[model samples]
Target: MPSIDLTINTDLARRILTGFIRSEIGRIGLKRAVVGLSGGVDSALSCFLAAEALGPENVLAVRMPYRTSSRESLEHAQMVIDATGVRSLTADITEMVEPYFARFPEMDKRRRGNMMARARMMVLYDQSAAFGGLVVGTSNKTEILLGYSTLYGDSAYAINPIGDLYKTQVWQLSEAVGVPEVIIKKAPTADLWAGQTDEQELGFSYREADRLLYLLVDRRYTPQECVAEGFNEAFVQAVVRRMRRNHFKRLMPPIAKLSNRTIGYDFLYLRDWGT
Candidate 1:
């Protein structure tokens, strides 16, 4: 496969993302941010950036773990909290989700995982309200493009500073911003289940997926073009098809066009109310 340079100027990206967090939060008339720290690089980086942008006192990192969650997950999350000195709270999600899980005994791991994810999101939003802050998002572009996230769950956010960065870039930026080396090196997982790792679940490594996604989506290469560039034809086709199938996850729910001023169709100006 043709090599793609995913290397980024970490200093520059860090500056831009920190500024983005500050500006986005400021524009909403809020000075604080609440982040769900999953002990993964993505959330760790988001928490770090948020703390830098809004001061440690202004950023709250919430770790929501289920019964089967790893001890390392909590330890890793605490590492970020300690390293950044951000206020944090740990909310165990096992109880919150177990009732539903018990109600549907037949629900498989995927369904259970989704419930855990949404349960964590609920905790973050509740903390957002209690802490008087906006919810900062941690999902990266690669995951978003592949629809790896659960809608209204890990995918929901008031503002996302790292959403445009690919998963490869997320690691680069994380290392640049002093995210724990262990976190940067750990297998990427949501910790929703005992042995659930992201790449394993997706059936492809982030490195492979990110490279192909960069070519196909960022570079607008067709599947045939990607194959010509040395990507496996089947792999290219699969990634492209998945991206097409998940396009809706990247967009707002379609509003049926009825009046001249539809909410999403015509009323699209974010600053129409004069921010």
Candidate 2:
């Protein structure tokens, strides 16, 4: 049985991702990139790469925090800005999200959390137009595979350099790209509320998830194969079920087929589609 080790060449990965950012931003005829910083390793890695790719002055790292967001998250976001010399701003979504939240007094944590994520996205896109930057996403392969992100919110991005990377691989690249050690070592969170950690919500650590996900997704291991390779059967079933349930979140809203060349179904982006 092949063991799951998602180790990647940090230096090579950095060069490729930075190049990808530069190329994608240039393709959009923009020299600037905007990143919503959450003081997490994923976003920190994106900030570093974008700054290197588009020059620090051209990269905008926005901290869109809710009132319940942790102080450490805000500070760590600033640390990333300071380290990369990226242009930065702070947008407090507490005020922006208050109206709906005030109106719906009985909203649960999941509903409220999704609202906050979309609220931050609203701030990022407004800043994108103001700063002449494209919104770069921070989600990695593990979360993307696990459906751990809010769609059209944290998942909304003009382009993503790290979507192909696993969470464990993200930390490795972060170190090589000079991301802060403190940011790299901290527990991951959406900062939707105080005392919220991603692992606690997911009921599994990224380290464990990465290994299993690499086996299941990247290597295309069947659940039975994954179990045979040492994963607990219950855990394998649970992960598979989660992935299947959230598969729709990973795709664009489906268009009912009518014309042979429907917009999303057939009118796809092609090489040299525009100047």
Candidate 3:
């Protein structure tokens, strides 16, 4: 609504991709990057960037699929590994998760989804330590803004190269970087719940949502201003409300200020480790 051109320069995009990887490496001293490849565009982009940043020898991709995961997903994941020449592992997590779901059959789908996300993170972190690598997050800015990711799950990461881009932008970058067509064209799904699509769950198209978010967040457009520019008032309000409400998830946990400079209170850093 606040006027998005949605145009990307192919040359500039290539530069941005390299720049993000370099910036992350400089900030975190990345030796390697570990990623959970769900056969999705975001993960594909992250893996591609990791391979580019630290070389394929330093990138490890793990595929953790539950019982309901699609076979095509695995195939697509294999394609990414082959294309990027990165080493990969397939750890079917059905055995790990089924037992918990059996105990709590009535667990909300969202809760189960969160568990799945967190389980993958746990596995990725362990792999990171075992291999002396960092966990690269796959979430984009649009999902982060909409609170669409699970806390400590897909949300937690050692480094995130694509966190600043929107959902639609993810596809563009994925294609530019030579991600598989199957993943790029497929419906965006967390693959947590069966038959669940991201657009369907969000109740809005990525184009519409990205536009409104750009206005409200990027352009600093007020709610009334967004509505006047042709965005639905209710939709704009919903997005802004969600962004404000979930601000905590995007930040380090709050620390009590008993001392002069409590951790995460007064001290802030662009580096991951404090020296």
In order of appearance, the predictions have TM-scores of 0.97, 0.97, 0.93
Predicted candidate 3 versus true structure: per-residue lDDT over 205-262, tens digit per residue: 8888888888777888888898899888788888888888999888888777898887
Clashes of each: 0, 0, 0
lDDT of each: 0.90, 0.91, 0.85
Model 3 deviation from the true structure expressed as Cα RMSD, one decimal place: 1.9
Q: Pairs clashing in candidate 2?
A: none
**Once superposed on the true structure, which residue ranges of model 2 sit more than 4 Å away at CA?**
none
Which portions of model 1 miss their true places by more than 4 Å?
A: 1-3, 271-273
lDDT of 3 at 229: 90
CA lDDT, candidate 1, residue 233: 78
- Report clash pairs, candidate 1: none
Question: Which candidate, 1 or 2, has the higher lDDT?
Answer: 2
Q: State in Å the error of residue 75, model 1.
A: 0.7
List all candidate RMSDs to the true structure.
1.3, 1.2, 1.9
